[model samples]
Target: MSAAEFDWNLATVWETIAEELPDAPAQIQGERTFTWADFERRANGVARTLLDGRASRDDRVTQYLRNSPEYLEVSHAAFKIGIPAINSNYRYRDEELRYLWEDADVTAVVFHGSFTATVGALRDRVPRVRQWIHVDDGTQPCPEWAIPYEQAAAASAERVRAPWGRGGDDLFLLYTGGTTGMPKGVMWRAADMLRQVNDVSTVHYALEDGAEGIRRDLRGPGQAHISGSPYMHGTGYFGATMAMHGGGCVVSLTAPGFDAAELLDSIDRYRVASLAISGEVFAKRIVDALAAEPGRWDSSTIRNVLTSGGMLGEQSKRALLEHWPAAAILDGFSSSEGFGMGWSLATKDSIPETGRFAPGPNVWVLDEHEQPVEPGSGVIGKLVVRNRLPMGYYKDPDKTARTFREINGVRTSVPGDHGIIHPDGTIQLMGRDSLCITSGGEKIFTEEVEGVILDHEAVTDVLVVGVPDPQWGQSVAAVVSVEPGAAPTAAELIGHVKARLAGYKAPKHVVFVESVPRSPNGKADYPAARALAEAQRQPVA
Candidate 1:
């Protein structure tokens, strides 16, 4: 098909790649490597199984697995079958998982065996889930109710063509970090997503030329890009998609936890051209490893190192360059709803500040009156993006309307990021709004943690805030007041919150004050509370 005839569906592009470069590596994980041919055939088989199980067009498929080939394979299968694949955080406890799946109205689930026990406990609760496909990790057996992923992959090899067919209008649901009450699913249309990817991507896809554009880029064995972030997050998933669009190999680390050595080994083993990470969290760890044992890993192949979801400080970027000067460190400032908002690039010659970024072409800062903030005006405004945006939150019109609004007659996505536009047109991002705390790239809502902390009998009032940290960009700190006779250790309060929410959302530091600082009107005095916590905060060590 010609580029003009191409509708920009992800499945079409991937199918074309399979035909053009069947032997090229599509994905790699240690001993396992999936060629483009293998990727297509397996995705076809999974799609066929979903069809046989009565999965319908635009049905939601939740990926409950970690960083692995199955994650993308399932997404590929969903695209072919006109289904919207949903990402389920692997860190989510039972309640969070329940809330996410229910909110997304997930119809099918592809999970790893490690989560079999957890799924087994909640299976009866979510009856809408008709198909349960389990990927084996050798830790637990696939339950009787769940279909083995391998079995599904071996079911059929024919290309999946749903009765309703597929198009650019197909949806891809990405759930945001639950900052308010619960996480909301950001619905992205395949066409908009494709255009957005093309807008920022080095390789351009000619909509007029159709599949030939993909064939044109099929120049040698594709580049190998390593993603260290969890696939459930935007940084990892989008990075994988961007790599695949270039017919590049997406390499994943198999280490259950973040292991700097494993990442370095993977880079050397795969000759990785790009390494995508989540800000200074991973960069610091990588630097520390290189510092501890210099000249240990041969990292000459990496030409680009990208960070998103958090800031990569100048110090961390410079440290990384010391080890691999050939690599250019790229830091992106974006959110689940807004991609290509702002970015900063660092090389041996130049390294920008941590939170400073070059504004994306369509990005603008708007003041309270919705007027564009003048450059160098010293005014903080809501960062907004104009084109190639999402279709809004799934099933939540109110939030969708609020987040995706018309600004000065143009549709814009205002995801609540505040920033200042410098005189040079660069952006100095302040952060996400006041209530949200970004720790190691995870957005934790103070209200969410505070509500959980308040559930404890000993705690009468609580206010959660973010404190600066060397490793995590910020750590969750809780300032609390207890009942007059009650005395609770910080661990007890932390454990109480951890039991209800994800461990990352739990307070890393706790400050026990006589009373939580509140204003005359009973509103929280966040500034004073932050000061108190900063002074008395004790790490949970």
Candidate 2:
């Protein structure tokens, strides 16, 4: 195929793979497996269903489900028919769900049966959603208003190539877990996303060689890559995408939450070649399970243990290597807006200290003046990716301007992360500058939690901060002051926050004080609050 005959859209690439490797397994969940041909046919059926539901090109389709084969199938169908698939955090409450769908202008939603009640309650509120596709998980039957996913997947077996055709400009909107206040959708074009992954990630496609390149690389059934992370997040979705791009099977855990023992068993059962996990949160559990039950699972098939979203400290890496000695632990330093910023590879032979990373080819540490920071100068600067960046935050041009900038004549994505470049060209990652607390790979904004805590009648004032934790990189801590006569226990306040927001955003450590530290003008003294929380934080029992 010539350059004119092919576009850089992922749909085309995926279709090419399907045509080339029809017998290869594409998706696996426990006892269920779908080959490339099966995958293609199901996606085509779903695509026809979406079209029948009047989903237009570039229309937003939301996936409000957990990790399952149906999630990827719906997403593939959307991509095939030129619809942008949007991710919805299943942990979200009613308000969050409403805000995301309304903000995204979602036209269609493919959700699991478990979320039937939530979706039913808010269905009328999100009037823009014209189509509701439901996947049965034995929790509930298909609602009258929603189309059953399996029925939709069997609508037609023929392939679906949209009339608008595929283009590089087709989008995939990834909503960032609200760092400031409300979640914002980051718009990623198909070409940029494909280019970054193909060049930097495990999947390699020679653009000049077109479909032939994909055929050449995917000679047989590719490696089995499994991830316990939710497909709603970037890490898990990208890991699965990379595997599919290489003609491999995307294996997902059926458990609703992360299960270390189950993951181990699945890896051994499927002969999984690569495992994707979040940092210390998952590593600690996996390491402990293996330590407790020695020689219980055959983990020799694992060659790569890929992780991102949080700090996988030196301790966890070393502990993990003890079990999978031959496995290479690839710690990816990335974000939703900018991928391949920096990465660190650790093996039994070589393990670098925590926070030290080799920057990507297009990554640069820019100073306050928007110039490159001098290496070995010990100056911390914002980490920037100069190429293959997302379009910007959808419908939020202000944030788009703030994050994605044209610096020194090149478009760069500055996602508020700070780091220092060493003389050896390695980066010392210093975390984000936005005061966002990343506990167990979840970004929790202090203000969001503080607002919820203050809603309690007994609470007079509250200041939330992040304190160091051995397990999570940083744990959310709340310093609160009760009313003059009211006495609310820490558990009460923590529960209050959990009821309002996701459990991960709730404060892990709650300290009651006489007053919250603030300036004369009532501005929060963040440093002082952090200090107080750190001083009073109790040891995890």
Candidate 3:
């Protein structure tokens, strides 16, 4: 590709790679493998389906399914047809699901059969959703109104031509549940997002001057990558897209949820070159699995282990190096809003601190007064991107104003994290401030968890707090004031939470009391709650 004909959009770039390397392996999900040819054809089939709907440019399509080839295909399909795709958290219950779909103004949904009841229930609520594309995973029968994924995909294998082509101005929405209440969509334009997060994320690719240069750089023995995290999230989606952008193969986990044994089996079978994961949650589990039965699976093909989207502590990093001695472990710092804030590389020779990263040219730290914080000041401040960043929160003017602020006339995305800038120009992260706890790299908003726990029949009042743990950076502890004579055991209450919110967000420990401590004005005294929970963890002495 020459300068006059260069195209940088994801769909175009991917089609070019397929044209150049048609026989190469592109996608792997459990027993299924898609060659570049197969992937391109299926993606085109999806594009043709959307074209039949006459989907105008910039329309929104939401994916309400777990990680699968269909998920990626729909994203690729939407990209080619000049529409944006949104990722919905599969763990969300009925009302939460309704909020996201309605708020996004979703035009279509490509959902799983398991969610038939959920989406079927929301059909009358969201007026904009005109099409329902259903993929049958056998959890339930497809809703009668939905177009079967098989039939919609019966179009020709060749790519379709459209009057409106995908361009750098096109959108990619990454919806994040910021520490507090509902999820917010961070909008990133295609061209900038590619170069910023997707291009530099892969280990196999080096710095290239332009999009064409990167394309030429990709024409080698492309790396094969697998992510232990769910593909819907950044740790999985962005990492896999990085590999895919470099003409590499992306092997996905086929299990319904995070299964250590299944991920290990897939890695060994595919000879995955790069493995991506989150913080302590995944790290401890993987290390323990390897330790339980040494030499049970081959991890020799893995050369790079990347951790991001959460803090991967030094203890977990050390354990990983002990098992995979030959791999390079890297800890990256950034949020769903933007990238290039900070990074740390850990090998056998060097191990980085738990929440520290080497800050570079593009990222900056700012004090409460919106001024740049000098290194070694010991002052905690919000992490902001000084250079290229996202446009703003989608359709959220008020939040956009709050987060993406103008500092000295330049716009930056403040990801709502308070941290320290060390004398050596390293960043020491203290995590987000929304009463949100990060266990194993997944953000657990306290308010949402408390809302679910309060709905239980036996409970009276609850305050969810984070406590220190060797595994999982912090475990959720619920301090509850139960009704008189109500015998709700810890296990039973935990089970109740799992049924409501995602299982990981459930409190690991539940402490019952006659009354929960609260301030006079009815505000939660988090410090008091933390102390009470910490006291509960101590052995009788």
Candidate 4:
């Protein structure tokens, strides 16, 4: 496919790559590596099987696997047949899992062995889900009700054609972050998303030469990247896809969850070029691991540390730099709904301000009235994208209408983030507007307070929220997890925030827990933390 004739669907680019670099390594997990040709063959088999099983275009298939190569295999297969693959959070319980499956109206499930119990329990609940494909990771027994993944994947190796031609119109459902509420599926057209997420057909590579340009760029020594976030989430999955598209290797975790040492080992073993982490939790854990034993892993191969899905606080960036000074730390500000908007780059010589970004050229800041916020005004407005955006939230027409609305005659994605577009064209991200705490008519972004508190030496992890106060209406409450060998008092932590930010922004109450509640992917669980914060505190004025 030439750059001029490139199809924007996910399958087309993948096919172009597979045909060009048939023997190049595509997916890497520990000692195992599958070449582009091998991965495509497996995907072909899955596609043929699914098509034979009466799976139609745009049918939703839920993937409940852990971080593994099966994720890409199934996702690729689904995309080939024009099916929208729905990523299920592996950390979800029975109810949560049922809710997503029911919401997506999942026709089939591809789950890991570890989740057999949950899948089995949900089998009767979601009776419409007739197809169950189980992956045997040696963790648990393959349920009798399900077909072994290998058996299904080996059904056919032929390229299954989608009767309905694949295009940018193919749906890709990415469930948005549900820190405070149930997650919403952000539906994206493959073509639109390809252009939005990655400038593939455009100026990135020499599209004029097509496959030749691809071969020239991607034929060399592989640039390996390991996504340290959940495959079920946008950050990791998209990173994996992007890496694969570049003809680099996508490395998955050996263990089910975050193991700092294990991650370092993979980086050392594979000579990984980049590492994608979600936020501070991942950075802190890695920093702690490296700080504990600096010589444990040789991290020289890593050139870029990519952070997205959540904020990578300034202090954590510094800590990460202290360990891997050679890497360029990039903190991308994006959401499931929005495409590329802004990013912060930190090198050894320069550490970017936390939450500040080099805004994309298409970025915009719109006030509540839908008017553009004037540059240099230092006014906080809703961060929005004037560029091409996602289709909308799946099934939720109300939310779809609200999030993807016309701003200045261009359809936009306002993912509820607040920011100020500075005079220099840079964007200063405040935080999510949905989580903004209003106290006595003062709007305080929880991220600002949390960032300051996290800078303290005694703090490990923290989430700031608003607890009801009689006088202030809602006072800041810091739910923190202190570092070992240090017991920072509530007043001391409060002082930490006050020293950095305004006194009014400091948490009036502190709830020190064993650990902050988080999704398996280490993303914050604001609802759980808010509940904990609200439980113990008495009425305050």
**Cα lDDT of all candidates, in order?**
0.81, 0.81, 0.75, 0.79
lDDT of 2 at 197: 61
Q: What are the models' TM-scores?
A: 0.82, 0.82, 0.79, 0.93
Q: Highest TM-score among the candidates is held by which one?
A: 4
lDDT of 4 by residue, 1-541 (tens): 5444555466766777788778888888877788888888888877776665566674678889888988999998888888788899887778988888888878889999988888888898997687899988988878788888888788776776778767657888887656667878888777666655346211244544544566665544347889999878877887777777776778888887799999999999888888888887798889888989978899888888888866676778887887788988888877777767888899878987777798777778888888888988978888888766777888899988988888778888887888877798788777787789999899998877877777787778888888888898999888888778888888888877788677888888888898888776767888888998999653223
lDDT of 1 by residue, 62-180 (tens): 99988999999998998888878898987778998999999888888999999999999889989888999999988899889999999999878788898988888888788875334
Tens-place lDDT per residue, model 3, 429-533, is: 655666768899976766556656665666656778988878999988998876568998888888888996678888888877776665211235577888898
Model 4: per-residue Cα lDDT at residue 387: 64
Q: CA shift at 12, candidate 2, in angstroms?
A: 1.9
Span of 10 residues, lowest total lDDT, candidate 3: 203-212
Candidate 1's displacement at residue 3, Å, is 8.4
Give one digit per residue, the lDDT tens place, for model 2 in 11-116: 7778898898898889988789999888888999888888864656757889998999888888888888776889998878999999999999898899999999
Using TM-score as the measure, name the better of candidate 1 and candidate 3. 1
| Candidate 4: worst-modelled 10 consecutive residues by lDDT | 200-209
